[model samples]
Target: MFPTLLIVDDEQPILHSLEGLLSDEGFNVLTAPNGYECLKTIDAEHPDLVLLDIWMPGLDGIETLREIKKSHPGIPVIMISGHGTIDTAVTATKYGAFSFIEKPISIDKVIVAINNALNFRKLEEENIFLRTRMIAKNAIDGSSGPILALKQQIIAAAPTEAGILITGENGTGKELAARTIHQFSTHSESPLITVNCAAIPEALFESELFGHEKGAFEGATAKHIGRFELADGGTLFFNEIGDMNLANQGKLLQVIEEKRFCRLGGSRVLDVNVRIVAATNKDLRQEIEAGRFREDLYFRLNGVPLHMPPLRERLEDLPLLVERFTQSWCKSAESQPKSFTPEALETLANHDWPGNVRELKNLVERLLITVNKETIDLSDLPMPYRTPDVQVPADGLDELAGISDFKEAKAAFEREYIKRRLAECGNDVSATAKSLGVSKSHITKLIKP
Candidate 1:
């Protein structure tokens, strides 16, 4: 696309000359008679660059520049004036004008200014894109053994066309794992379409997945492309797939089994080349046994099982995660970088993290916004994560006294913690499980002894 330029001047001959000159130089030119007309044209057509004469009847170039800077500061504006003064030029520059050219305009100088401004905008856009991609990659950043293994597993599975089923607690980075795979795959350039099974209504399932033709159903005023077709030659991520009803499970199974599906109210068979990646926090085996999920669908979806360990289990990576979150958030907030005290980091690592990595990220952001100190201490942590008093009896350590390995010690500590929480919650299995950030099945196992 050619860069568009909007020229604003009260002189009719000047407008005609600039428009013709810029147009001949491969610019899409727009002419406005005065300041009001310039703003009106700007609102109607977002031109890449603007040229304004300082002397106007109603609103002059300086006033116009201020208004433009307030709303569309990204656009570059050049000031033109015949009665040019040092003060006038400085004021234009102060009001955010890109450059100044005298009334006797030099075509060469104008072209050079136009190219420089456009190139500047392009560089700014590229920086934003690179930063966004870096942040996405950092979403899965971890150095713990489990995370290392998970990364290696993703690297191996990404190149294949096989389906992936990711299981873990909520906020365990299941979606991030799927994205990591997509980024490393042959279809990395293609879209990674996502559908949250739990969020979609059961009534809209067919239309949502297969799309609908115009007048196919109520509110089908126009033809719609469903998730399946939209994800052609890409990836389809079914988040919380276990939440899908059994009836929908069978329909999805059919789609997976045969890559071809017909749109609703349409007979044409459309073939799609999409890789399926599913995630769930629920135990699908139990769901299958209970007849809430289909056994056949389970076998088909679990092509390469990937499980994300909860944050508590990967406590060794807390420091790295905290540092990354801090750097990322602080940069976004445009503030000086903040460091966490050793005591504070240790407190964060020791927590159960029921909400997992997401919970930690939220805490970091909260601290960044709320805490005024340069160094975050234990006191800066939320009340729940701060050092707890009198929760676990000293006698609890006796059972796991000889467990020297970090993993074994953590397991023992978690088991004992769950036991105390259960007693405190009055043996309410559900409440205890919720408080401790584990599933009921896990709590039951802890109470087996």
Candidate 2:
């Protein structure tokens, strides 16, 4: 549908002229003779753009602008004034008006302003919609067994305004977990600010989390807004919290407990209503025992502890993960979708994944690029994963030498060799069995024990 425009003016002639001019320019125009009528029209029509006159009777332009902003902040309003002044333009701009145009209006200028305002409104609305979708996707995709259960628990606890401490190994999607909780929490509509505890220098960590007033330091030219202030009425995700210094941890605990903090070089205390979500790879309990972390701070942040399992423990989900990664990479590369052969898949399934899901994803991407085959086979597998002999121990014969019967000895060797090959190739049983000159099902049976 075409965008709608609202024209507000006390002069009937001006309003009539604007309605006709803008309508001819392909806008759905609504006309109002006074501020009250303009507001009423806005409530009813919900126009995309507004051409508001500054000298309207009853409510006047500034008051009307304020009301419009409060009711529909996303809609862009251009302030039109016959006796336009610098102060009037500044006030209108400050009250969220898109632009101020002086009267004795030009039809061309009016059209330009209307089009720009409407386009700006469209872009802003699109951005908000995209951000909302991203947050929703993160929340839904975060569900993976233990993580999913923890997410549900977080949703239940988030509304209560309790502090949260998320514990997991590096790259275990801890940040994603924090974001999911924040998005589902009572503060879902509010900001979710993040601060990297490990990235920030120790000396500046306190000032970054809690704002510093002007003159607080040599480079303090102006008062700074800190993460806590920015996250007011929302959530603050402190990533790598275990890396925070002992001194800063104490201050953080105090502010979290009191819900208030004073900026550096400032005597006045600023109150905040923010939910804290701290994430760390290290064990804070150990840090406390070592006297590197404050015990009190640990308890304060551990209100609702959540631990995410590493990717290795969830090996059953590898196939699903690989499919997802491959599809995503294909889309990004603008290439046709690729599939893995049974041998290729078995090769992947047998490996001990040290780097977890992240490593697997990287390997999949590498295979897609390096392997030219439409259906990746055993030879297409990377060097480290090509065969079992390289990674398997040479204690091979010694381990199988105990079997007395020839049939038993051969079967045992076959089982051990197939299993080792599968592990080296990432678990491609077909590829491993093929390399061993045996049927896939035979290798599968031998390795069943």
Candidate 3:
């Protein structure tokens, strides 16, 4: 694709001459007669580079450069002047001009400057793409049923202006999920402001969320920009939002529903276009039943629901999760990557992971730093995971690959053994248990749910 340049000058002859020269040099050229036309062209076309004249009618070059920096900060502008000076060039640079060129512009200098500006823009775009990609992958790693479902929900909800409620146990990566959604959303270009509702004091909840004007109350010495204003044109991640006090929930609901809010002790109503993504470990339904949470606010926030299952339920994915954590920790710590033995991985799967993925990641980090061994084994496992809770009769090492107490391994073996006996003697629970020399309840327990 050819690089597009917008040439802005009051002189029609210079504009036409430069346009033709740049077009001949394999470029798409656009011309604007003055600052007004320049700004309009920039808004409509979003050119790769701008050649702005210092002596334009109405808004001059320096003033125009400041506005450009404010609105389209990524686009580079080169300033041109008939009477260019060191001081004038310095002033233009301060206003965000990329380069300063004297009039009687040499096409050689113009070409060099334009090429540099375009290259910088291309590099900047590549950096953004790489950054967003890394943030998404590093934030969450999984391919379990629950994780797959959550990913699909993010893909569907990201493009819209819908609010999302993320519910899960503590340390289940709620904050990362919010960031992942924002990274893929239409609001990816803007910032994602997070508010920790549980940490904020009840007395300051309103000011913290909707800003506070000067002298709004005691200790209000200066005006403050709230989370909503800072997240304008972006995402507002309300971390632990269910913990916010009941009274403040109404105020938040009003502004969120209306898309407009007033600062404390201020008459002017400020507008914001922000997508809200709230997360909590608490069960909002139970809170509503107990009258501790407001139903109206819950309904407002839960436009789409995403639940992250606690890691125990997905024991099948433990080895993959552990491997990811170990690799990430080693890479960050500048050490050789560590490996886990089959028995060690099986040890992890057998235990109840009450802390979920976050706990497993922390454990991996701990093990990586403290244990210098290339391969971590079952013997290196923490105390509780070392027990042989599920004993295998005629067990081969491969079949028992470490997870025994998860019920499936032991239950499957027992159910098949009993079925073999029942087929020989005819299906009878009492007869099978007695013949197998086990209690009837024991035989009943082995039956698959």
Candidate number with greatest TM-score: 3
Q: Residues 109-171, candidate 3: write the lDDT tens digits.
A: 999999898888889999898877767574667788877877898889978888899999987
lDDT of each: 0.88, 0.82, 0.85
Model 1 residue 67 lDDT? Answer: 96
Model 1 TM-score on a 0 to 1 scale: 0.59
CA lDDT, candidate 2, residue 143: 41
Q: What lDDT score goes with residue 143 in model 1?
A: 85
> Could you estimate the TM-score for every candidate?
0.59, 0.58, 0.63
Compute the lDDT of residue 84 as modeled in candidate 1. 96
How well does candidate 1 score on lDDT at residue 285? 97
lDDT of 2 by residue, 296-377 (tens): 8888889988887787666556677777778889999998899877766776777777676677888898878755445666
RMSD of each: 16.1, 10.2, 15.2
Alpha carbon deviation, residue 75, candidate 3 (Å): 15
- Candidate 2's TM-score: 0.58
**Deviation from native of the Cα of residue 102 in model 2, angstroms:** 29
Stronger candidate by lDDT (1 vs 2): 1
Per-residue lDDT for 1-449 in model 1, tens only?
Answer: 99999999999999999999999999999999999999999999999999889999999889999999999999999899999999999999999998889969988998998898889888878976875785476457878899999989998999899889999999989998988888877777677899999999999998899898998988899999999999999999999999999889989999999988988989999998899999999999999899899999999889999999999989998999889999989888899989999988987877899999999999988877655557887755767888575132456677687887989988888888777657656788886666545689999987797
Error of 2 at 368 (Å): 3.1
